[model samples]
Target chain A: MCDSEGSCHVLLLEDEPMILMDLEFAAEACGCNALCATSVKQAMKHLDSERPVRVGILDVNLGEGQTCEPVARELERRGIPYILHSGDLDRQNETVRSLNAQLIPKPANANHVISTAMECVGRKCG
Target chain B: MTDDEQERSRPSQAMGNPKDFDDSPERFRDENPDARFGGASEVLFEQAMAQTRMAICLCDPNKPDLPIVFANKAFRNLTGYDEAEIVGKNCRFLQGPETDPEPVRKMRQAIENEDVVVVELLNYRRDGSSFWNALHLGPIYDSEGKLKYFFGSQWDVSDVRAARAEEHYAREMARELSHRMKNMFSVISGIVNVTGRMRGIESEAQEINDRVQALGRAYETTLDDASAGRIEIGQAIRAILSPYDVGESHLRLLGNGIRVPFAAVSSIGLVLHELAANATKHGAWTRDDGLVEVDWQEKGEDEQRVVEVTWREKFGPKVTIPADAKGGSGNEIIDRLLRFSNGCIDREWHEDGLVAVARVPIWKAS
Candidate 1:
C-alpha cells in the first residue's frame, strides 16, 4: 500500500498482552500502521505526540480495575471513531456499558477485529 | 395437759379477761416496748414479702446444709416445695436436670467467696415446668460482722429470648431474599444479551434489548405497585407496551383504569408484551397500511368483571397466522401467567383481519 512503510496509522487501546499482540499483527497484516497502548493514560500520551492516527480499537475494560469510558468519551469529542472490544460486555459493570460505541466481543476473530476497526475509521474519516 | 381441761381453760387467760390484766394501753407499752415495736414491723415485712414475684429465700450461713430459715410464696412456687418441705433443706434443691450447670457452678463459687452472684440458669417450677431463670443472690451480715443469711431471687425470661431469635431469623431471610433477586436480574440480562445476538440485524437486536430492558423496568414498576397491593391496569398497559410503540399512531390504547393484584399485573404484562411484539413484527404496525385497535370493558355481572384486551390487525400484507411461530411460545407464557388468575385467551380469523382476545379477572386489591 505504501512505498516502504505501513498504509495508515492505527492506534489500539487494549489491556491484555496477548490480545494486544493479536491486534498488532492483524493491523499490520491489513496494510495499516499500528501504535499500541495498554491504558487510557498511555493512549493519551501517544495521541499528544502529533502522530497521525486514522482509527482506534478500544478495550472497554482495563484488567487493572480501570475503565476506558472516559477515553471513549474523549475520542467521541475529538471526532475520532472507535470500536468497543470487550469479553465481559454482558457480565461487566453496568455503568461502563452506557457509553456510546459499536461493541465487538473478544476472543473475536482477528479478521473481524481488523475489519470493524477499518469500518469505524472509514465512517469517521470519510 | 388434759385435752378437755386445756380447751376449756385456754379461753380464760388470753381471750376472756384481757381487761383484767392489761386494760390500760400505757401499762401494756411500759411492760413490753420491744413487743410493740417488733410485732408491727414483722407483720408489715411478712405482707411485703408475700406480694413479691421474686423468689426470696433466707439461708442460715452457719449450717452447711444451708437450711432455709424463711421461704416466701414465690420461693415455694419456683422450687415446687412448700414451707414445711423446704425450711429444713438446702436451697440447692432447686437445681435439677433442666438447670444449666455453668451459671450454677459460677453462682456457687460466688456464694462461697461471699460475692454477689447475678447469673442465668434453668430452674424447675411447681409442676416440674422448666423456664430460663435469671438468679441474683447476695449475702446478708449481722451487726456482729457474722454472715447471717443469703437472699436469692429468680426471674423467668423464656419469652424474651424466643422473640429475639425470631427477629434475627426475619432479618436474615430479608437479606437472603434481596441477594437472590439481584442474581436473578443479572441472569435475565445475560439471556437478553445472548438472544439479541441471534437476531437478524443490529436494529432488531437493539430493539430486542430495548424491549427486554423495558420488561425489566416494567417488572420493577409493577413490583412497586404490588408491594402497595394494588395495580392500575391502564397505567400498567401504558408502561408495558411503551417499548413497542415508538410514538406510533396505529397502536391505539382504549381503557378505563382498573386495579388488580401483583400476580395479575405481572402475568398480564408478560402476555401483552409477547402479543404486542408479534403484532409489531407480523400483524399490525408491520406495514404503514396495517392498524391495531386495543379496547377493554366489563364482560360479566357481579364480581366477575371481565377486562378484554383485543389486538386487531387490518389492511396489512396478506397475513398467515404463524401457528408455530408466535402462537406456541406466546400461549405457553400466557397460560402460565393466567394459571393463578383463572383466565384464558381466544383467537378469531376472518378474510380481512386477525384478532386476539385476552379475558382476565378484575381481582380487587387487598
Candidate 2:
C-alpha cells in the first residue's frame, strides 16, 4: 500500500556498523526505504542526491571520530524531520533538546527505532 | 481545716527525711496534734526521691512570681543550674535559639491557661550541649481542690534524632545507586547495538565487550587519577591500548609528555584505541609488514593547544574500497572521533600508503 506521490524515505546516519544494520533491518521491515550514512558528509551527499530523503536518524557521536550536528541543522532548515539515537551524554545540548526531536537511546531494538522514526516522520510530514 | 494543717495531718514523714525537718515538732504542737510521724516512712521517702532519674520540680502555681519549692538532685543535674539558681527562677530560661518554637509556644500557652501539658522541646544543658527533652507538667491539686503547685518531669531523647539522621543518609545512597545503574544500562545497550551488527555473530558479543571493557578501564583510570587529585595521561593511555599491542615495536609511543587532565586523557585514549584497532585489523598489521607510528606534542601554550596524531600504513592488501564502504567501520570510527569541535581529520590516500592525521585540542594541566 505504498503511496507513490508521498511515499516516505529515511536517512539513517550512524557511525557504528552494528546499529546501522539493526536500523536498516527495522526500516525495511517497517516498509520504508532507508539510506544509511556513516558520516555527516555522506548523509549530506544523500540529501543532495536526486532522490532527496525527508527523514534522518543521527547518532550523537559518530565513533571515536565525528559529529552530526551540522547535518542535523541542515535537515532542520530543509524542513526534514530527524531523530537522535545515541549513548553520548554530550548530545543532550540545548539545540538538540529544543528541536523536540525523538531520541532513541542506544541498546534499543530494531522495531522500536523504526517505529519511532516512522512516528516522527509521520507527525512532521503530515 | 487550713491547707497547712491538712498537709501536716496526713503524715509529715511522707515529705522525706524526718531528721531534716526540725519544724515537725512545731507543726505537731501548735498546728496539728495528729501530725507526729515515725522513722520508717521518712527513710523510704528519702530513698525513693534520691533514686529516681527523672528531673522533678515543684513550683507554686498561684503566685505568678512563685519560686521552685523543691527539686531532686536530677533536676539540678539536668538544668546545669544548681538548686540554688533555679529554685527562685522560672524554667523559661531553659529555652534557647535552636528550640522548636511551636512546641515551646504551645507549652507556654498551656501554662497560661493552667492546662496540663506534655511536649518535646529542644533545650540546652549547663555545659551548652543540646538535647531533645520530653517535658510533662501537671497542676497538683490540694485536698480543698485548689491547684496549688505545678509538677514537671523531663526525659532526654537525643538518641532518636540520631537514628532519623542515619535513615536519611541511607535513602540518599539508594537514590545514587539507582542513577549509577541507569548509566550502566545505557552503556550495555550501546555495546549490544554495535556488536549485534557485526559480521561474525560468534565473535561480535566478545568484541563488543572487549571495547566496552576498554572504555570502562579508561573510566576507572580517570576516576583513580581524580581521587588521587592528579591525572596520569600516559599511564591511562598505556592501559587502554594494552589489548591491541602485538609487541613493543607495534606501538611506537612518541610523546612521553607531562600528565594531561583526566577528561583529555579519556577522549584521547578512545581515539587511540579505535585507530590502533583499525591498524591491527585492516591497515598495517593486516600483514606482517605493517607498522603504526604514534606521537603527540603540544602546538603552543595557549588556552587550547593543538595536539596532532598520525597513523600511517606501510604495507597491506591494496586497501580495496572497503566492501562495506558506505557504512564502513573505519569511517564510523573516524566520524565519532571528530565529534568534538576541537577535533578534525585530514586523510592522505596515495599509491605509496594510507595516512590519517588528526588534530585535537588539549587543556593545560592545572
Candidate 3:
C-alpha cells in the first residue's frame, strides 16, 4: 500500500550532503525510494506526510550537537526498524543504544548498510 | 584573641651543635631553650624541627586555646610570616576567603577528636596571594599519654595541582582530536560512495568502503587498550567478524589469552575481514542456519610462538572448490594484507563450506 508505486520508502537522515546522496543511491539500489533529510525538522516533516517509511537509517551526530534520537524515537513509535550509523558514538552512548538498533559503523559498505535495512524490512513485512 | 596570637617576634634561636652533647633528659632542658617536650629526644627533635626545610610548628594544647607556641624557620618562610607574626597565633591567619571550608571543617573535627588528619586547602601568603597548601596536623602525646602539643606541617602543592589540571586538559583535547579523526574517515568514505555511485562503480566503491571500514575497526581495536600495547587476538577477530555476527547465533568464537601486538592488529583485521566478506558473498553466511566458528591456538615456544587461527564454516550449501585456492585475486588480497603481520593464510573447501587458516608469528614479549 506504498505511494511510490509499490516501492519501499526508506528514510535517510544524515547531516552530510554527500552521505545523504550516498544513502539515497544505496536505497535506490535496494529497490526502495530514498526519503532524504539533512535535519530532524525535515525528517519529521517527511514522516508527517502520509508516505509509508518502512525503514530508516539515522546518523547519531548531525553537527552542532544535534542528534537523530528524536527521529529514532518517532520511528520506534511507528514500529519501523532502523540502523544507527555514526563515527564518534562514545562508548557510553546508552541513551541511543536503548533504541535497540544495530549500529552499522561509519565507512560501512553501501550494500551492507542497505541489506541490513532490507533484513529489518523483511522481518516487519514477511 | 588568645594570648598566643599576641605573642611578638623574638630573636631566632641558634641550631645547637655543642661540643659536649649529652643524651639525657637532664641535659635536654639545660641548653635547648626550645625544648617543649620533656624527654632525652627533645634536643634531637627540636634541632631537627627547627632547621629542617619542611614547614613545621607545635601548638600548646594545655592552654585554654591551642596556641602556636613554636614556629620553625621553614614555617615562617612558607607562610611569609616571621617568627613573631606566626607564634602564639592559630594558623587561621593564613586562611582567607579563597580557602575551601570542607577541608577546614575536616581539620577542625580531627583536631577536636585529637586524631591525625591531612587535607589540602587554600592558604594566603603575607602579600595575600593564595597557594594550595597540603596541611597535615595531628596531636602529639607525651610518654604519660598527656596531650603535649598539636603538630602541624604545611607544604604548597600548587604546582602539583597545576600539573594535574594540565593532564586532564590534554586528555580532553586528545579525545576531541580522535573524534575528528573518526569523522574524517566517515567523510572520506562518504565522498567515495557519492562519486562512485554517479560513475556507476558501485561494486568498486563498496570494496573500498569495506577495506576502509576494516581499517577503521582495526584502529578502534587498538584504542580499547592503547596503553597495554597489545590486544587479545580473539578480540581483534571479534571486531572484524561483527558485521556477519549480527541477527543470529552465527559466529562461534573459541580462544582466549592469545594476544597480538597493536602493530599487527590492522593487517590481521584486514585479512579476517577479507575472509568474512567472501563467506557472506559466496560461502556459508549466505544462509540463515550457517555458523562461522573462529578458533585460534598458540603454537611453538617463546621466540618461535605462532598463532594458528582457523575460520571453519558449518551447515551451508555445497560449493565447488577453487582448483587454485591461493592463486585467486581474492586469496591474493588476503595474502597481501597478512604480509604486514608476518602471517600467511590458506583457503580450503570442506564438506560443509570454506575453511581458511591463518598462522601469525608472535614475539616473545611474554
Candidate 4:
C-alpha cells in the first residue's frame, strides 16, 4: 500500500499548533508526506486534494465546540483509515464512540503515533 | 435599668414567641381545622405547630377553589403575606413563571390520587423575590378515611440547592482542567518531538516522549472515575505496560483494590515503564516464549501500611550480575522517585529473568 520509500500521504487534523507540528514531523519521520489542517474546512480541502490521502490522524475536540466527527465520517466514506489521538478520551461520548477509529491517547510517542497510522493503511477504520 | 429593659434582657417564657401569637389570628378565624378535632391532644399539637419554624398551611378541599383556611405565623413570614392577604387565596400563589411545570403536574396528580407528594420548586414571595421551596404536601384524613384537608409544610432550601449547583460546577471545572492538562502534556511531548527532529536526536526525543506518555497514562487512570478519582497501583501499571504488550503470552496484570496515592502515581508509572523497557531490551521480553507478570498488593497494618508491587519476568537468557548493580542508573531512578514519595525498591537478577519489588508508603489505607 506504500511506495518504495514506505511512504504515503497522511492527513493530520489538529487545532493546537504545537501538536500539529509534532504530527507533521511524525508523519515525515515515518517516510510520509503530511497534509496538516488546523480547522475542519482545511481538513476537507486536504480530503478533496487530487493527490489523495492514504491515511489520517485526528484530534477529537477542536475548541469552540467543534469536533472531528465530520472529517472522520468523510474519511470513513472514502475507506481511508484514520487514528484518533485525543487528550480527553471518553468511550461514553456518543460522537467518539460512533467515530469508531482506533484510539491512541494523547501525550503518546509522536513517531509511534504516526507509524501506527501508517500501519492502519488499507484497513477498515469505522 | 428600667423595667422594660430588664424584661427585654430575659428570654421570653411565654407559651410561644409573643410575636408569632400576635401575627397568627388563624385560631380565631379558621373554623374548618377546629371542627375535625377538639380535644387536649389537638390543642397541644396546634401549640407545637404554631411555634415551629417551618411554614405550615392547611387548605380546605370542601371550600371553593380549595383556599388556604389555616396558615401559621412562619408561613406568613415566609411568603410576606399577612392573614388578610393569604387566607382566601389558593396555595398556587407561591408558584412563579420560572417554576418547572413537571413538579407542578406531579403535585396535581398526587392530590388527585390522595397521595403524599414531596417536591422542590422555584417559589416567589410577595416581594417578588424567589427562593427554592422544599414542599411536602399530603392529605389529612378523618377517622372514617375521608380526606379533610391538605397540609403543606414548606422549607426554604435555597442554600442547599446552591451548594449542589456549586458541586456540579466544580465537577465541570475539574473535567475542563483535566482536559487541558492532557493537552499540555501532549503539547510538551510535541515540542520535544519537533525539536528532536531539528536537532537530529529523534530517538532520544522518543525516549523522553515515552516517559511523558507514561505520566499521562498514569494521570488518566484517576481521571476515568471522577468520584473516587484515585489511581490503583495495578491500573497504572497495566496502562503503561499495555503498549508493550504484543498479543498473547505478553503481559499479565494481577491486582485489585490496592491504590496508589494521588501524588505518587506518575512516579510509580515511570519507574515501572523504565524497568519494563530494560527487561525488554535484555531480559524476558527479548525471548520469543517470554512472559512478564506484574502483580500489586498492599501489606502490613497501621504504621507499617505500604503498597508493594512486583515486576517479574521469565523465560529469557540470564546475564552476569554486575558488581556495580546497586549503582546502576535504573536503580538510581527508582530510588529517587520512591524516596521523594517515601518509598523504596529491591531488585534481583534471578537465573530465569529480572525481578524488582517496589514498596511505596501510603499515609492512609485505601
Candidate 5:
C-alpha cells in the first residue's frame, strides 16, 4: 500500500521489456500508477503529455546504442526526483553523480525499487 | 667497451681495409701488412653490404645536411628508391604527415648527444606508401675520435605493428563481452528470485525456464544479423508460437515487415508465449479445428510511429468468459507488457471466439 497520498503516477523508462514490466509491477504493488516507456523518445512523449508525474525510475541503457540520459535531464529540469537502475556498474558517469540521484544496480528487488521510488516522491515505505 | 676495442676484437678478414678501422694500436698490429694497401678487402666489404637483407645507410655528420653518403642494396629495395636518388638526401625525407612527432623529437635529442638510438616510426616510400620502420642509429668515430658518420639500419616492421593493433582490438572486444555476460547473468538471477517469491517453486521453475527460452530466442534473432540490432517482429512471434502451432494450419501469421528494436525482442517473445499458452488451454487452440490469426502493422508517422497487432481466434467451442477473466494473472502479464512498451491491449469476447488488439509505440530502424 502507498502512503496516505493515495496513488501517484511515476514515469518509468527502461529499454528491457521484462525489467520494465518488473518496475511497473513494483510501482503498482506500492499503489502507484506507472507510465512506462521503452525508449528515450517514448519517455519524452510521456513527459510532453502534461501527465502529473510525481517521480521517475530510469534504466541507463535504452538499447540500439542509446541511453536514458536525455530523459533524466528532462526530469531534472522539471525538478522531479528519480532513481537510476543500471547494469553498467563500471561507469562512473558524472552526469548521474551530479544529478545526485540514487543508483540501484541491476538485479534489484521489486521491494527496493518500490521503496526508492516512494522515497523520491517524499513517501515512506512501512 | 670502446668502439676501438670492439673493432680490434673482430677478425682482420671482417674489416674492409686497415684504414677503415680506428687507429687502435691492436688493430694496427692485427692487420696483414701484405693486404694493407690492397683494394680486395674493399670489394669484399661492398659485396657483403650489398648482399645483406638489412637496410643500411651511412650519413656524413660533417656535411651540412647530414646527407646519406652510402646506402646498401636492401635500403634501396625497402624504400623503393634508387641509390642515386637517396645518396645525397637526408633520411627525414621518408617522414610524412602521419608520422608522430614524439619519436622524431626523441631522435633529435639522441642525434644531439651523438648517442645510439632505436626508434619505431612511420616512414614513407618512393611510391608514397607507408611502412613501420624500426631504425637503429649509432655514431661511427675515426681514429682521432671524431664523429665521422651515423650508421643506420632499418627493418620493415609493419606486420608486427599491425599484429599488435589487432591484439589491442581483441582485448577491447573481450572486455565488452565480459561486461555483457555479467549483465545477462544478473538478469537471470533477478528472474529466478522474483518468480520464486511470487509463485511456488514448481511454477517458478517453469516460468524461469520459459523466460530463459525467450531470452535464447532473442539471442538467436540477434545472431541472425548481428549488426542490425533488430529482429523482424513476425519472426520473433513465430519463434515463440511455433512450438504450440501443433498442426501448422492452426496458427496463421501475417505482417508487413516490421523490425522490432533488439531490446524489445525478449519481452515480445514472452508476451507471445503467454498468449499462445492461454489459447492452448482455454481459447481457440483447445480444439482440433480451432484457428488463430495474428497480424501486425506500423501506423502514424515519424516520432509517432506505432505498431498495431491483433490476435483473432475462431472455430473453438463456444467461448465463455471465466469469472477471473478481468483480474486473471494472464491479463495482468499482458497489461504489464503492453504498458511497459507504451502500448495498450483491448480484449473482446464474441460468440465465435476471442479478439485482442494491442497498439505499441515503436522506433523504426534508421
Candidate 6:
C-alpha cells in the first residue's frame, strides 16, 4: 500500500529502457511505489536498502551474460514475493523454479503487471 | 628335395594326397595314418582363400621382419600391391603416419603374448590413399606347438564413421534452429503488444487491440520456461489485473501459489480485466478509501486440485446492479471460461460492496 505520498514501494529490475518505463507506469498507475534498477548491480543496491520492498518485478536476463537470479534469491530469502518478466522462451531454470516465483512474459499489459505486484503484496487490483 | 623340383611337384602331390597337406598336421595324421605332405586339398584351400571377400595374409614368424609369406587375391586388390611387391615386406608397411600408435602397441602386445587381437587403424594403399582398416590378427601354430605364422584379415569402415559424423552435425543444427525460432516468436509478440497500445485509436480498434494484448499476455504465462502451458493461479490473477491502477492501499490479495492449465489464461484474464475496469470506473477504485480484497485456496480431496478464488470489494461507492451484470458479455465470458475449466462462479451484493467467488479445477493427477 502507498503512504500519504502515494508510494506503494516496489522493486523494478529491467535492462531495457522502454520496458522499464512501462513497468514504472504500471506500478504508479496502480498507486504502488516504484524503485527502478537497470542492472543486477543496481537491483542489488535496492535490495540492500533498509526501506521495505512490498514486491518485486524482475527481468531474467540483464545483458552481458548477467541474470537477476541473485536478486530473486535475495527476495525469496527475505520472504518477499516476486514475478519474473522475460522475453526468452526458456524460463524453467532450476534455481528460479525452486523459488516457485510467478513468471510474467515480455510485453505484458500494464494491468497484468500492476495487479501481479498487488497480488504479491496480498492485494487485489480488480 | 631340390627347391625348383619341390615347388614343381607340390601341386600334383597336393592333388594326389589332399589329407596329407591339412593345416592341422597332428589332426590330419590322426585321421589319416598314411598322410603325406602333398595333396589336392592345398589347392582347394588356396582357391577358397583367393575367392573370399575379406583380405587375408600370412606372415612368417620365423623370419626377421615377420615378412608376408602368402597373400590372397583379395589382399592384393585391397592394398593395390602384387605378390612380388608385398611378399618380402612386413604387414606394418600398410600403416601410415595418421595411424594411431595405441592400437599398434596393443597389437604388438597381443603378438608377443601369442594372443589374438583386433584393431581398427588407418592404412595406406600403393596409391597413397588412406582407408580405415578393421584388422583381426591371430597366431597359427605348427604341429609341434611352434608359432609358425600370423594370420591377418582386414575390412574397410571409413564410410560408416563419416556417416555418423554427418548425423551428429545435423542434430546439433536442428537444436540451434529451434532455439532461434522460439526467440523470434517472443520478439514478434512483444512488438504486437507494444504497437497495439498506441494512442488515438477508436473504440472498435482498441477493443481488438485489447483482445490481442490479452492473448499476448496469455502466451507469456502459458509458455513459461517449463513450456508446460500451465499458469500459476496467483500469477495469473496478477497478470490479468496488472493494467489497472487500483491503489495498493485499496487492494488486498491472499493465496497459496497454484498452477492452472494454459487454456484458461486468456479467458480468465479478460474476466478479471473487465471486473477491474468496472471497479475503477464506478466501484472500489473510485475513492481513495475504497478497497478490493482477493484471496484463493485449494479445495477438495479429489485427484484434481481445485482452487476457489474470492474477489471482495469494500469501502466503495454504493453499487446499483447494472442490467448486464446478470447477463452481460463479461458475465458470459466468465461463465464459459469457468465451464471450460470445469469450474463455476457466483457473485453477491452486500451493503459494503460486491463480492464474487470462482471455483476452478486447476490441476489433475497428470
Best by DockQ: 4
Question: How high is the DockQ of candidate 2?
Answer: 0.09
TM-score of each: 0.39, 0.36, 0.66, 0.77, 0.44, 0.40
Candidate 4, residues B1-366, lDDT tens digits: the string is: 743234333443323543332222335334543454457756655555556779988888878888887777678788887666777789999999999988899888888898999999999999999999999999998888888889899999999999999988877767787788889998998898889999999778877778787888777677645456556666777878888887757888887777656776777788888887777777888888888888888888776777788888888777677688876566677788998888888888888887889888776644
lDDT of each: 0.64, 0.64, 0.76, 0.79, 0.73, 0.69
* Candidate 4 lDDT for residue B303: 67
Worst 10 residues of 2 chain B by lDDT: B19-28
lDDT of 6 by residue, B72-109 (tens): 65776788876567776988999998999998999898
| Model 5: per-residue Cα lDDT over B1-366, one tens digit each | 744345445554423542332322233224323223237665555445645679888788788888887666578778987655776899899999899998888888887899999999999998999999999998988667888789899999999999999978765665465446545744665566456647756355545555565555445445444456666777777766766788688998987688767766666666677777788878899999999899888888877887778888889778887677757566788789877888788888887788888777776646
lDDT tens digits by residue: candidate 6, A73-123: 898888888898765534335545665788875555555776977887778
Question: What would you estimate as the lDDT of candidate 5?
Answer: 0.73
| Model 1 lDDT at residue B362 | 70
DockQ for each model:
0.04, 0.09, 0.47, 0.62, 0.10, 0.12
lDDT of 2 by residue, B248-341 (tens): 5556566665455556665676677677676666677777666666666666567757666666666655766545543556467666766663
Model 3 spans with C-alpha error above 4 angstroms: A1-12, A27-58, A66-84, A91-126, B1-83, B90-119, B122-131, B134-163, B224-234, B254-263, B282-308, B312-320, B339-342, B346-355, B360-366
CAPRI-style docking class of model 3 based on DockQ = acceptable
> What DockQ would you assign to candidate 3?
0.47
| Higher-ranked by TM-score: 1 or 5 | 5
Candidate 6 is graded, for docking, as incorrect
How would you encode candidate 3's per-residue C-alpha lDDT over B1-366 as one tens digit per residue?
432222112222322421111223333345335445646566666556545667887788877667787666567668787655665688888899989999999989998999999999999999889999999999988768888889999998999999999978766665665566676777778788888888989678778877787777677666656657777767777877887786859999887877777766776777778888888887789888898998889888887777888989988789787677676555788887678667887777898898888988877464
Model 1 agreement with the true structure over B1-366: per-residue lDDT tens digits: 643233223322422432222112233235325224246665555444556667776677777767776665566566666556666677677667867678978887977999999987877765777777778888987667678778777777778778888977765654444333433443444444444444535345444544454455455445434545676777777767754665576667878777665666666677788777766766666777666667666577547866777767676667665566334555677766766677888777654467778888874533
True contacts kept of each: 0.00, 0.13, 0.61, 0.87, 0.16, 0.13
Candidate No. with top TM-score: 4
Q: Is candidate 2 or candidate 4 better by lDDT?
A: 4
Docking quality level of the chain pair in candidate 2: incorrect
